[model samples]
Target chain A: MSIIIKSSDDILPSEITDQKVFEGRREFIKKIGFGSAALLTGGHISLSHAKTAAGKYSDLPKSAFSAADKLTDFSDVSGYNNFYEFGTSKYDPAQKAKSFNSDPWSVAIEGEVEKPGVFNLEDFIKPYALEERIYRFRCVEGWSMVIPWVGFPLADMIKQFKPTSKAKYVEFVTLYDTKRMPGQVLKVLPWPYTEGLRIDEAMNPLTLMAVGLYGNDLPNQNGAPIRLVVPWKYGFKSIKSIVKIRFTEHQPLSTWNKIGPKEYGFYSNVNPQVDHPRWSQKTERKIGEPFWAPKHDTQIFNGYAEQVAHLYAGMDLKKNF
Target chain B: MDTVINSNKYSSSLYNPALIKPAVFILCLLPLMNLVWNGFNQGLGVNPAETIIRTLGDWALYILLFTLAVTPLRKIAGLTALIRVRRMLGLIMFFYASLHLLAYVWFDQYFDWNEIVKDIIKRPFITLGFATFILLIPLVLTSTNKMMKRLKRRWKTLHQMIYPISLMAVVHYFWMTRADFRQPVIIAIILSGLLAYRLFVYFKKQQSI
Candidate 1:
């Protein structure tokens, strides 16, 4: 079962154009009506306007991996969503979240961390360099998407804050505003949604603190300001509009797991062998795929088991699930 | 009293079962036609399979409810001819329900018998919906005039299962939805209203007798 592993470092210098040139190359390719950059980098061409602007965020680092598949259409990524704070329907968030106020936001990082204080969104993101990583996002509800996210690794951010030795897990909390988020008035789920990850999982290189998608600031519906993006776990684990990050000694009760423990587990890794209580999780229908598109088989740890399997060395996934 | 009865008869006569029955039959096909048109035209949205499955399920439930309302409508409106369309409505309900089941089997389960069986046993919502579909089988089979004449009183008893089947449909819907029970809640309210009307009519008839 040993496979030749090729990290992005193994890529040839010619394969990766300078970030500025890459940005310009995208537009040049799009203007010519050919996916030339995709041909060179084996990167997916996002069908949505490609890039509305060629300006690259200087702070973010160049991505390590470019997916072989096409980036999900931007409309599908932004429009079809499950940010229940806006509403329960898939279309609800886009319509309702637009009015949500994310400006002048601050996030408080506390608990077992050495530096514990409220930092405004701008200052918090200023220090870390952002990277455009294309990752597979799998939802517990049997759907998936490949998104090119603009962010830095969660570990890189956590290291600067210096988590104490006692820190075993990290907890994330979302904003709790019912006035703007009409859906919060109804108790579809416990308000002010929360999610958590093991400290080791949090420190994983694949975990991203996303600030933007497709080289633009996140749309209101897509967890504006900042959100966690854990590629291996279920999409819910990647909490949105995060206001607080607390390093904890014990596992935090995630909102979904709190409401339906039997249905949603804390460690919701994408494993085809382990099915959800109500539905089979063996396959997922990619968003915006054709009606006749055959569902692709669910991959273990969403095809990141090579990097993340060691984190859960001896625990039974079925039991944890 | 004579004038009121005459007016009722005049209005009822306007319905003209021969014309109304065929018109209603065509009207009942509109949802299916729209669904098929949308399916062909790429109007079924991003998830066409899900849309088809859900739309068929919704129409089946609506048709079943409509079929259940026929007796109550006839009694309340004093339109005896309304009873003529009841059989047609029942067959239509069966048609949509069968399609719903087929869509789920073909698209969702991919004709995976083992998976389908597992779904029925493991998922309470599917179990209830499956039972509801099963109950329609006898009702649809004996919907013919000859079978109705052969069974006589027992046929009515057999068809009465529609009440419980309708209840199961609502409950199945309620359970399947993740949240926002508004749709199922509305369905529940409609079924309750229909049931209440039947009860009121039954009691009034009993008193009159």
Candidate 2:
């Protein structure tokens, strides 16, 4: 269940955008004085205004992997979140995480990695150029959204960390602070949410280490500073506000799986056939659609099966899920 | 019994069913009216279907609890006129419950009977909710004055099903909740209090006999 290495000729020309050219175009837009105005004109007027108010991540090149589907409204994406770190309700994160401080964040990289050290978020993300990858995000709760996530591939970051041969899996942990994240005061879930992926899955080109969304630095509710974005897996597998990364030899315990092993599986891939214990995953309500709109039939691996199916080939998805 | 009857007559005269019944009916209708206003105003949030279904279900449970509370409140507070509005409240609870089920069927399942049947059979929470809705049918049918007069003693025994129906609704809610049990737990506690009051009255009656 591994991908075959392809020669340079096998790659599509559209997939090979020159980073310098992209950055040059962005610089030209900024020089022309339309950069901020262009961002301010779209459906996300409030979001763009907020970004300008904060003045963060103004120049990001769009990625080749960006989805062609219509993007979910920025307000819906930001407002309706399942960040248990803030609270259990969907609206709680946006309301409660307004004052959360994500500044001076550092991620401690340890276990089976050659260059194991605590790297400041700025230093960690400085090496790679950020791009906007609009991805289809499917939640285990049977709702889906297409999000424009800004980050580089997790594979690029992994190569720099230099994980040893003993590293069979990569585990990520979210920041744990009772004062900043009031929801942590309750033991709703074990504090400091955790998620993991197989070494191959972590190195998948589709796996992103997101730092921003909608051309702005990540909002506090959407896991400010840094987060993982595994497009094929359920949204929870993409742990947010990560403060720790550990390359381990065994499969790590994820927060949701730990809470309800039978319901939330370790490999939470999007499969219509494998329904959640309490609800059917066969269909998903696209956020921001009219109430009368029919549900979209959920696709296998959220329509990323062509890219990720090889990783789980010959394995029982129903059992794993 | 004579004093209780005398108090009922006195309270009935004071409250005036003509005015109080209409007020209670309008009060019960306000939640539905608010939902309609929100629907027209784009106020149901991101997922309107989910919001409509959940809000309708919440109101149904609330009205169900309110209907159950009428007896205890009337007995304890000597507001016997409250009993006159109980039937209307019960019917309103049925209305919300029907809307909730319809939203799930039409918006969620898209009238796919196969999927709906499968959901009722496979999912325990759905089964409990569907069963609770079904149990309400007999009670609603026998609610009219003519049917009540004809059935008389049998009607009293049949209406007791509300107790179990309310309990099942709460259990359905508890099962569907993902993590936070605060909402369901609070409903369960209030339901327990209502049932406890009935039990206390039953034991007192038996002791007197």
Candidate 3:
């Protein structure tokens, strides 16, 4: 049930000592005759407070991209999602995604990889060290969220498999099943949502293969079991509930780009200068913020410019966007 | 003819604006009230601005179409007093539409006129919606009895813009939506039916003449 790999290598013994020392000292005192139920209750209450004060995932290293803003309430994070497979409305996915079964899920790694074939979801990530990364998620629709995701660098995962030189692009495919995903009844998007990234982009240190968020197992609405979290690109580039990953020399057919080539480009990087055909991407309203809260200026490469801008050095972001 | 006579008699006693006007006023205010209540209670989901925008937009479209149906319904039900409420309904519809625009301007754009203008020009949906709002201004201004009397025949012709305005609103809704377009599709069908009904009545009147 624990999707996060809480290995000794990833979580240092110091972290465990840090968590237990105070509580352990209290327990030791309680065993000595002076302890009473009321005192024990008071100590227990303080211990819970200490846990939160320490940080949600105290063991994991804080991500460089962590936003200064407070973490959006978990309710909003789970209740607001754009999983088209469930439904169109933001609320629809939270309500309707319950039907999807992500358990016993496996990802098929094929095309130009040295180790190519089906791999169980758990086994696939067992090798790499898992960590919590707080990333700014910018949707193409001019809205955003700062999500605390638990995963490892995508480059680490791909490196283990050793992609062949032919692997110029990394393609991700979402699970497709009409019975579970009723929104498929409408031709809003091509079935089995697809997304792609340049191999360098995929290998970027910021790229994450997220399996948990808010220090818990990923909600179905939030791409349960496993999903991609590409901090620099627009959210659609971070496809959810991935079932297939293929490496190719040629660029893969991204679903949004295929659906509306002009509006949604294959790159889909966050750029304030390049406006979407329907709306301006210059600013984004952070979800869960008050109506009066000033909209934040959208950054080029979603504020990861220093980390990712090098990949697209000479390329025109205006055209690629 | 007999049904009309009977309904006409019934309407006189049943359709009292003294009672209906206040009731309709409260009914019209329900969507706004619900939104405010949700805002206070944190019931408006994660993206409350979006929920508010979409909810207000739906009410605006609903009231617009409902206002347009008044004439046909008045004739069919023989409720002559229904005409008395039509102006109010039309104005309320406009009120909701204005709020919808305000939601986008203040919450979405944050009073950024340059960006908004750019969006209005660059985006077809915003353009159509903006055009529809612009066309509605004259009709709303002229809804008063004094303007109606002053313009006379011209008033009737000018108000006919509602037919196109309604269609534009529907198109605006259709374009705004990305996928699962059932709501816009249904609204479009109803609008077409309303327009077709007007056409059928127009041709019938011409034949009789």
Candidate 4:
């Protein structure tokens, strides 16, 4: 039920070891272990003191982006989830996602790739350097979460796939079925959620195909079994439960955009300027705090403009938004 | 309520309908537990406490609507077993709704009556929500078995207040989430249909004579 690949050529074993060894950051890592990743299921996610003490950020040494938002006002990472496939209730995925058989899950890299085939999750992603990117995820519902995600950037992965010149857009699709994903039964949303990225955006160093969050494999509520991680856009744009990754010249029709054309758009960037039909997007309240707690102002491009902003050069975000 | 509270009048016997009482009590505790867990884990994630309070408040209204439907369900299905469960469920509906109100009063306003009064007066959603919750007070006060016996012929007339309360709950839900009216609309339609069934049954009974 496992597929092993020997392509750790670009990434060194030292890097992996470094990520595992966070001795210098023991105190911070210890605090994070007990903090954002706290799930309510009586502790199904066990955090050994090892990962924290090993040499935490020494693993993700330098990147264009800043560290994970550690301000007290930053939202809780674990609970900001779009687990509709597991259930409509926010926490249902955390409870019911156990039934999902992800070890056997395989990711398909197709459509405009030179190496277009179905490779097992191990062979597809194991070779890449798993860097921890601290990302600010903004949901369309006007909530936000700052997650420390561990995965290779989407560009890095796409380069490995060797996408052809015809590939102008990248698309992601979740596993769609009634059995494992019981929430599909209720059809709270249109099934098999699909999202897309412009070619340059997908290839940006910041955009990621994350496997884990808070230094652990993603809990079901936060899109286990593989999902995209786009820090700048609203969380929905980073589609969850992905079973397919396709590269095409044509723009993909996003599920939410198709459902409600105005509310969700192709480039659903986190812009305080553009408000949702129902609620203001100016500010978001951090989780695990008081009801009347003051919200931190949401940053445009989720504060990644310095590194990733050029990708959207001359493109009117307001019109496209 | 204590004046009508029956002390050891009813026994744990075959005629008492044992399973129904426990189920109602269990259902009552579920929303409270849901609120507590959501609070502790910060499950709402965005404005955790506000979202938790709001979500629990919404659940209270829905449970209240569910409680109101029991009598109409009994009339429609022609089931006598459904009748015994109604009072217990009704009290729970009120209990959660009261907690929801208390959350708003204490946590949301810091027990500031001025703000609470202003919101109730100004916001249509809060107006209906608060009014519907207030309507539950009399119903809960009279929920005891002894009170049921004492009220006798008057019980049915008094309990009719649930119709307006359920209507206001639906309206409040609709007003809160303005975009997707589908959920609240479905609930409102069901509540209307359930009441219609009772009206139809009442007219049909007279027609049979």
Please report the candidate that would top lDDT against the real structure: 2
- The regions of model 3 sitting more than 4 angstroms off are A1-58, A64-69, B1-18
Question: Scoring only chain A, what TM-score does candidate 2 earn?
Answer: 0.86
Candidate 2 lDDT over residue span A109-132, tens digit each: 999999999989899899997877
Q: List the residue pairs that clash in candidate 3.
A: none
Best by TM-score: 2
DockQ of 1: 0.45
Stretches of model 1 off by over 4 angstroms after superposition: A1-62, B1-19, B196-209
- Compared with the true structure, what per-residue lDDT tens digits does model 1 show for residues A51-141? 4223445234556543434567677789878899998877889999888888999999999989999999999999987777767889988
Predicted structure 3: lDDT: 0.80
lDDT of 3 by residue, B79-147 (tens): 655676788899999999999999999888888898899889999999999999999999999998899
Clashes of 3: 0
Worst 10 residues of 3 chain A by lDDT: A46-55
Cα deviation of B81, candidate 3, in Å: 3.3
RMSD (Cα, Å) for all candidates, in order, is 5.3, 4.9, 7.8, 10.1
Kindly indicate the candidate among 1 and 3 with the higher DockQ.
3
Fraction of the reference Cα-Cα interface contacts (below 8 Å) that each candidate reproduces: 0.37, 0.69, 0.66, 0.29
Off by over 4 Å in 2: A1-39, A42-58, B1-18
